[model samples]
Target: MKVLVTGAAGFIGFYVSKVLLEKGHEVVGLDNVNDYYTADLKYDRLNELGISKKEAEIFKRKSVSSKYSSFAFIRMDLEDRTHLPSLFENESFDAVCNLAAQAGVRYSLENPEAYVDSNMVGFLNILECCRNHKIKHLVYASSSSVYGLNEKIPFSAEDNVDHPISLYAATKKSNELMAHTYSHLFQLPTTGLRFFTVYGPWGRPDMAMFLFTDAIVNNRPIKVFNYGNMERDFTYIDDITEGVVRVIEKPINDRLNEKEYYKLYNIGNNNSVKLSDFINEIENNLEKKAEKQMLPIQPGDVERTWADVNGLIRDYGYSPDTPIKEGVKNFIDWYRSYYKI
Candidate 1:
């Protein structure tokens, strides 16, 4: 199968591309390589996939991977109206895994326009291209944050996500709605996976795990939001990628006769770990105590997030189960080597 994976330079995207290549699928990875956090980290991830920083700089130029012949990459944005359609027409991809989006929830508060451009306008381009090209399957990244302000203990796919606390969550929820429109009208098989607190090696620098680890290593005080009363269903990157691959390969075929081929699932570790416990795992891995600074929860932040992944398990026959301790150890080892700290 030929697959087009958007945001292939990102943490989860890079891992997913690797898995798809291992499965002998010809993959064309795409990314704009924006500097929302660190462009160097994004380039380094591309380097791991055998795409040189030099080749990645050229816009829309497909760079074949030095290691994997089946894997290639293109530096481009999802919102490119002209180029995106051309690429779809040329490549005629069998499936598309749209993981590209402006990610941080808090960052959306500062730069809401970024979210509108990438998550909203950009996603519309993807849907248009997929619909025009008649792509078989379209699997996209959603977020657990969409279940904002809901008092539900375990967030489920069926739960009402109409009220989102953050702009980022609202955009993600909109993506689901937009995808459903295409799925129903054009018979496109679309699946949205609402990811939980995803963390592991090659993780984003803005995330809690990376921030806390970096601050702890440098002897800086780490902020404990919500005064250390937060819990998250932190899912590992490998597990997330595996579930994505499964969904991409197996599209929604149950409702082929009815043209109701849209679905959503929560991809996360079913167990929710307390914030203090998660910090303890990081401290254990780094062998350094963190100077904690308890603070009130920032705006656009949720008190806790717990994913009910039964829908994913029932449909894909897979669930994220990486223990927090093991995931933290892997991340710390990678961080030390990457930073030489």
Candidate 2:
């Protein structure tokens, strides 16, 4: 199958692209390569997939990976009205995994426009292109943050997600709504995966695992938000990639109602580990104690997030099982090797 994976330079997108290539699928990856965190890290991820820094710097040009002939990349934004449609007309992708978006809950508070452009306008472009190109499946990245202010212990796909605490979450929720609209009106098979606290090697610098590991290794203080009272279902990258691959292979069909072609699932670990316990795993792996600075939860921050992935397991025959200790150890090892610490 020929697949188009947006945000291929991103953490999850990189892993997804690598796995797809390994399965002998031809993959065309697209990413804007914005400097929301660090462009060097994004480029490094591309390098791992055989896209050179020189090739990745040029926008809108397709560059094939030297390591995997089936994998190629293009540097472009999702919101580009002209080039996106042109690419769709040219490629005629069999399936599209749309993982590209401006992703930081707290950062959205400072830069609301960025969220609107990438997550809102950018997603619309993806839908339009998929609609026009007759793409078979459109699997997109949503967030557990969409279940904001809900007192539910384990967040389920069936539960109400009408209240999103952050602009990032709002945009993600909006993507789900937009996907349903296209799926209903145009008979597109769309699936939205509400990811939990995703973390592993090649992870984003802004994420908690990366931040805590970096601070601990450097002998700096690690900020404990919510005064050390928080929990998250930190899903591993490998598990996420595997689940996404399965979903891509199995697009929604006419076995259900015509309007029910749209589906949403919580792709998460299903085990919410406490914040202090998660920190302990990192400290244990690094053989160092963190200088902890307890802080109040910032605005747009949720107290806790736990995903109920039974629906995913039932549908996809898979569930995330990586333990927090193992995941943190893998991250710490990668961090030390990457930073020469």
How well does candidate 1 match the true structure in TM-score terms? 0.98
Q: For residues 30-74, could you state the per-residue lDDT of candidate 1 as single tens digits?
A: 999999999999999999999999999999898999989998999
Lowest summed lDDT window (length 10), candidate 1:
251-260
Give the clashing pairs for model 1.
none
Per-residue alpha-carbon lDDT of candidate 2 for residues 33-145, written as tens digits (9 for 90 to 100): 99999999999999999999999999999999999999989999888999999999998799999999999999999999999999999999999999988998899999999
Global lDDT scores for all candidate models: 0.93, 0.92
Once fitted onto the true fold, the runs of candidate 2 whose alpha carbons sit more than 4 angstroms away are 254-259
- Tell me the spans in candidate 1 whose CA falls farther than 4 Å from its real position: 254-258
Assess candidate 1 and give its lDDT.
Answer: 0.93
Deviation in Å, model 2, residue 6 alpha carbon: 0.3
What's the lDDT for residue 175 in model 2? 98
